[model samples]
Target: MLKSTMNQNKVQTLKGFRDFLPEAMAVRNYVKNLLIDTFETFGFEPIETPTLEYSSVLMGKYGDEADKLVYSFTDNGDRQIGMRYDLTVPTAKVLAMYSQTIPMPFKRYQIQPVWRAENTQKGRYREVLQCDIDTFGTNSPIADAEILAVINTVLQKLNFKTFTILINSRIVLNNILKACKITEDKNSILQSLDKFSKIGQDGVTKELIGKNIPKAKITVLFKYIKQAQPDEYLQNVINQLKILGVSKNNYQFDPTIVRGLDYYTGPIFETVVTKPK
Candidate 1:
């Protein structure tokens, strides 16, 4: 009995990891296939990248807060390396490397596992599968609109009854902060603001105040954020979405929808399901 118990302990998976048995894997694979089909239908070809990248390549991309969650180590080669944090960075590297060969406006989808050193939570994990579709070589809001349409199609196809795709632009966010005379600590402010959904306005105020942002500036920040409207770029994206036949009910402009990722420059979006709640 003692030997059996020891063996079980040795074989157990590490914390924040999971082993999907056949029963679970069946469902997982089903969803993966569905995503692949949806992606291909939208002219997105499949691509894969390495699970490990040089430490230098991974650093300084995501903002300070998210950078801390990256899993990195010095390998036996004495070379510093990092596990994939998310699919976007690696895909960007791919585009740069093959820029000579790939045509403009390239669309690619990636489905793979990524690792991060996050505190274990109910629905969050250190190792999680990521499914992403990215369009490179385009500076058009129409491209952004296509992404929104794709999100709506994917979720609706999966039988999601009620969900909203929240969209925001860092341009508008930056403009608001600029109007507030905030420049030096913009990243910090955006990181805190990204938590608006989880933490209420009061919580965000507390966080900003803790960061030594002047109380007056905080007041101005909130005021500007409330008064801010989507710029012409975002307005064009919305108009294009309607042209693409994306239901207006599925997506809306949300000022508080600032994504936590620092690398994001233009439009950022997130989805929330409301039916099961």
Candidate 2:
């Protein structure tokens, strides 16, 4: 007997996801192609990886709150598997797997969709597209400048103006937090504070309080978080970049911008559209 139409699965996409109609897809393709061209122009070669990776490989890298949002499951073989949350970790894995074949100082660009099972906000979803360019095996300041240039190029090419590039250093934030008696669970605390923009100071206070971080400790930490960055390393980086001829107009030194990724050992930055909502 044939299955009844009523009993069939509905042709609907999951929550936090949507069907991209032709027009929307066209716009997406145009933007993605533009980004790809920009990356290639900067000498970043393209690379791809599997969308699914071992949960073990992804976990403990993005910190606690992020790990909680990973779409993970145990396969029939009893191996824990997870969808890629970001492109960086998988690229590291690819480099490790093909180290013999890959050359030193690999410069690669990967464009793909990443998954994170969380409450979707406007223009943010459980699954979202990402375009990334990464370089490894180098500690040169020039590499950092090229990255900033690529970012500026991509945004300018997309006709974006009035955007701010907020920069911070995990090492700096970690030092400040350590002085606050938060000698451990730093990522958990950082992840909690990561919600400050969305949930406000009181919300972050509540989260850290629930984490058993002393109220006094949170108070001390928030004090320094609101202050200007006392770390000179990032300041020196800024000066170097200025010497490299990158514009200082878009640079913002936001101490509270502790990215919730455990693997971020040094500097971290994000571009924000400052247009009025």
Candidate 3:
């Protein structure tokens, strides 16, 4: 009876969380190792931070939408804490704490699991592993170009044949907002614009209109953005990529590639598989 009861009471993983059996774990480990090898080849050192942090450390860092997704609670000691959302913010705090000790232009890689309170979707989860490589303390365009090179190298090593890296700058989008005379909150408009790829032009227009942005302004914004070209700084980054030998076929300028994250200041990149879904 006890054995039958135990079998009946077997526990399963929570929604949006998963358990990996040996076969799945093996593949995960192999891919992680490959990523580490590629990052190290580009001179990036690994670093790690705690999975839990004071709520104060994370709040007000990733914007309002992201803040809502943070898993925060009061602990037994009554100290508010939150799970790690991404590696970038913690890495920023680390840089601030160790600024005097760490050298300039610090390049580091971190691969860790992050937690978010996201609604379950096909592939979206409350907990997901993120691999990040970041360079700090340098404003040089070469560093940006090197990131593109590393991306190309890793994709080629992974044997992905037909993928395109969409590149853009938030600066360009912000300038567009100004040129369009958009008096509404820019983040709101940009958030909708960021959905262009997922929802397409008509969908984004509907979203913007729902936000009460004038239709005329939306039209002007669309027309102006279509005519917008890469500015001098972005062109310089592209030139550096050519000098670094990253394939020109692998990337292109995309004004519509505005990332959803609120922290992106300069260039941003997203890779899409063209040949496969």
RMSD of each: 2.2, 3.2, 1.8
| Range of the 10 consecutive residues with the lowest summed lDDT in candidate 2 | 1-10
lDDT of 1 at 76: 93
Error of 2 at 230 (Å): 6.2
What is candidate 2's lDDT per residue for 1-277, written digit by digit as tens?
Answer: 2456645856457889978999999999999999999899989999998988999899988867789999999989999999999999999899889999998788899999999999988878888888889888887656766777788777777887668778788877888887787875777888888787779999999999999999999999989888757366677667776765667776677777777667888878887877532
**Candidate 2 ranges beyond 4 A from true positions:** 1-10, 74-79, 119-121, 199-216, 230-232
TM-score for each model: 0.94, 0.85, 0.96
Which stretches of candidate 3 lie above 4 Å from their native place? Answer: 1-8
The candidate that wins on lDDT is 3
Ranking by TM-score: 3, 1, 2
Question: What local lDDT score does residue 230 receive in model 2, on the 0 to 100 scale?
Answer: 37
> Model 1: per-residue lDDT, tens digit, 1-277?
9989989788667899999999999999988898888889999999999999998889899977788899999999999999999999999899889999999899999999999899998988899999988888888988888888889998988899999998889999989888999865788898899899999789999999999999999999888888878899999999999899988898878888788787888888999999757
Query: Which digits, one per residue and each the tens of the lDDT, describe model 3 over residues 67-115?
Result: 9999999999999999999999999989989999999899999999999
Worst 10 residues of 1 by lDDT: 182-191
